[model samples]
Target: MLDIRRLHMLKTVAARGSITAAAQSLALSAGAVSQQLAALRHDVGVDLLRPDGRTVALTEAGRVLLEHADRILAAMEEAECAVAAVKGTVGATATLAALPSTVARIVAPALTALGTDHPQLAVTCLVTDQAQLRELTLGTVDVVLGQRYHHVPETMPKGIAVSPLLDDPLLVVTAADGSDERSFGLRELATHHLVVPPATTDCGQAILHACRQAGFTPTTRYVTADIAAQLALARSGLATALVPRTAIDPATPGISAAPIEDHPIQRLLFAATRRTETTNPTTAAVIAALGTAARQDHTTYLPPA
Candidate 1:
C-alpha cells in the first residue's frame, strides 16, 4: 500500500522543485524528507525523481503517481467533509489566507462573528500580499480572500471555486480642506504629484492602465506597496493617492476621498476554496460569516449592479 503522507511529500517536492525547499515548507529536515522519498521509491519500484542541475525534476513515473495522489487526497477530503456533515458540527481547524487590507477590513469582523456563532470551529488567518493560491491546492490553507482588478484578468486555478464578495472602488485621496467632497476626472490627475503602489502589483498595474487610458501618464512622486504609506503621503499634502475604498477608514482625519467620476476603476473581492471542500461544515460556516460581515459593511463598498 502507498503511504499517503509520502505521496503528499512527493507533491510538495514537485511543487517546490527541490527536496530542500519542500523540506523547509513542510518543516522537516532534508534527510527526513529524503528518507521518505526513498521509501516511497522502493515501494513503488520506480524512479520518481531525477536531479536536474540544482533541482529535481519529476520523472514520468512521478507524474503518473502525482495524478493519482491528487485524486486520492481529494477523495480523502471529501470523506472528511461527509463525516463532518453527519456529525453536524463545525469542529475543525481551518487556515485562511488573505491580503493585509482584506484581513483588517473584512476578515477580522467575519472571524469575530464566526467565533461567536461556531465556538467549536477554530480558524487562523495569514496576512499576505499575494493570494498564495498554490497553498490552497497544497491544502495548506482552507480558503483565500482575493481581489481581481478591472484592468487585470486573472484565471482561477482548476478545482478552485470563487464567490464574489464586493466591489471595492478606487478613490482619489487628497489632504482635507474642510470643503465638500467632489468627484474628479482622470485627466485632472495629470497635474498632481501622485503616490501609487508599485507598477508590478495588480492594483498598481490597473491604476497605471487607467491613467494612460486618460491620455497622460501620472507623475508618480512615491511608489510603495503599503496603503498606509500612500494615505500618509496624501494626508501630509506631499502627494495625492489612488486607493481602494476598503483600505480607507472613513473616520481617519486629514485625508479626503472622492470617486473618479468619468473613469471608474474597481476591484472585485472574492473568496476562493477547494470545490470539494465547500461542503465541509467549517468551510461553509466561514464563507457564510464572511458574506454576512461584507453585507454589514456594504455601505462602505459599491456593490456590483
Candidate 2:
C-alpha cells in the first residue's frame, strides 16, 4: 500500500520546485525527504523526479501520481471534516494570510468576530506580500486575503479557489487646509509632487499606467509602500497621493480625499483557500467571517474637491 504521508511530501516538493525548498517548508532535512522519496519510488517501481539544473522536475509518472495525490489528500481532509462535523464540534486550528492593509481593517475585525462566534476554532493571521498561493499549497496557511489591480491579468493557480471580497477604489489624497481647490484629474497631478507606492508593486504599476495614459508623468517626490505613509505625506502638505479606500479612514483629520475623475481605478480584494480545505468547517467559518467584515462601509471618503 502507498503511504499518504509520502504522497504529501511529493506534492510539497512539486509545489516548492526543489527538494531542498520542500524540506525547508516541511521542517525536515533534505536527506530525510530524499529517503522518503526513495522509499516511495521503490514501492511504485519507477523514478518520480529528474534533476533539472538545481531544481527537480516531475517525471511523467510523477505528474500522474501528483494528480491522484491531490484528489486523495482533498478527500482525506473532507473525510476528517465530515467526522468532526458529526461530532458537533469544529475543533481545529487555521492560519490566515493577508496583506498588511487588509490586516488592520478587515482581518482584525474578522478575527474578533470569528473568536466570538466559534470559540472552539483557533486561527492565526500572517501578514505577507510574497507568494500566497504557494504558501497555501505548502500548507503554511489555510486562507489568503489578496488583492489584484483591475488592469492586471488574473492568474489563478490550479487547486486554489478564490472569492471576491470587495472593490477598493483608489482616491486622490491632499491636504485639508483648503490650500488646493483644483478639481483633480490624473493629468492635473503633474504640477504637484506625488507620493506613490513603489513602482514594483501592482498598485504602483496601475497608478503609473493610469498617469501615463493621461498624457503626463507624475513628479513623484515621495515613494513608499505603506498607504498610511502616503496619506501622512499628503496630510502634511508635502505631496499628493493616490490611496485605496480601504486603507483610508474617512474621518482622519488633515487629509482631503476625492475619487479620480479622469481615470478611475480600483483593486479587487479576494480571499483564497486551497480547494481541498474548502469543506473544512474551520476554513468555511474563517471565510464567512472575512466576508462579513468586508461588507462593512469602508468606502466613505471626505469630499475635499
Candidate 3:
C-alpha cells in the first residue's frame, strides 16, 4: 500500500514547485522531504521526478500520481470530517487564512462568536495576502477570507467554494480639519498626492484602475499596505487615501471620510473553503461566525438609507 503521509508530501512538493519550498511550508527539512519522495518513488515503482538543473520536473508518472494524490487526500479529509459529523462531535481544528483588512475588522468578532456558540470547535487564523488561495486549494488551510474588486474581478480557482460576507465600499480619507466641503471626484483625486496600498495589492490595483478610468493617473506619493499608516498619513496633512469602509476604526480620530460618488471602486469581502472540506463541522461553524460578524459590521458601519 502507498504511504498516505508520503503521498501528501509529494503533493506539497508538486504544489510548491521545489523541494526547499515544500519543506519550509511543511516544517520539514529539505533532506527529509527528499528522502520521503525517494521512498514514495520506490514504493510506486515509477520515476516521479527528473532532474532539471537546480530543480526537478514531475515525470509523466509523477503527474498521474499527483492527480490521484489530490483526490486521495481530499477523500481522506472528507472521511475524517464525515466521521466527526456522524459522531456529532464538534471538537476539531479549522485553519483559516485572511487578508489584513478582514483580519483587522472581522477576525476578532468572528472568533469571539465562535467561542461563544461553538466552544468545541477551535480555529487558527493567519493574516496573509492574495497567496492564500493557493494554500486553500492545496488544503494547507481549510478556508481563506479574501477580497474581490468589482472592476477587476478575482477569478476563482477550481474546486473552491466562496461565500460572500460584505460589500465593502471605498472611502476618500483626508485630514479631519481640512475643508469639509471639498468635492469628491476621481479627477480631483488625481491632482493630490495620494497615499495607497502597494500597487501590487488588489486594493491598490482597484484604486489605481479607477483613477485611470477617470482619464487621469494619481500622483501616488506614499505606498504601504498598512491601513493604519495610510490613515495616519491622510490625517497628518501628508496625502489623501482611498480606504475600505470595513477597515475604518470608529474610534480612530483625525480623519474625515466620505464615500466616493458613484461607487467607482468597491470590493466584495468573501470567505473561501476547499470544496472537499465544505462539510467539515468545524469549518462550517467558523464560516457561520464570519458571516454573522460581517452582517453586524455592515449594519454598524455602513450608512443606512
Candidate 1 lDDT at 195 equals 96
Q: For candidate 3, which ten residues in a row score worst on lDDT?
A: 177-186
- Clash list (residue pairs), candidate 1: none
Candidate 2, 1-305: lDDT as tens digits: 99999999999999888999999988999999999999999989999999999899999999999999988888887788777667755566999998887876788889999889988778988887643878886678989999989988998877788889998888888889656544567778889899998899888999899988888888999999888789889989999999887777766889888778778888999999887543666777888899888886454434544
Computed on alpha carbons, the lDDT of every model, listed in order, comes to 0.89, 0.85, 0.83
> What TM-score does prediction 3 earn?
0.93
User: What's the residue-level lDDT of 296 in candidate 2?
Assistant: 69
Candidates, ranked, lDDT: 1, 2, 3
**Per-residue C-alpha lDDT of model 3 across residues 1-305, encoded as one tens digit per residue:** 99999988888887788899899999999999999999998999989988777777899999999889888887888898788788765665788898877775788899988888878667888887674998987777887888899997469887788899989988888888745434477677867898998888988988888988888888999999888899899989899989888888865778887777753689998888888643777777788889988998888773211
Per-model TM-score versus the true fold = 0.96, 0.89, 0.93
lDDT of 1 by residue, 57-100 (tens): 99999999999999998898899889989998887688999888
lDDT of 2: 0.85
Better of 1 and 3 by TM-score: 1
Question: How good is model 1 by TM-score?
Answer: 0.96
Candidate that beats the other on lDDT, 1 or 3, i.e. the better one: 1
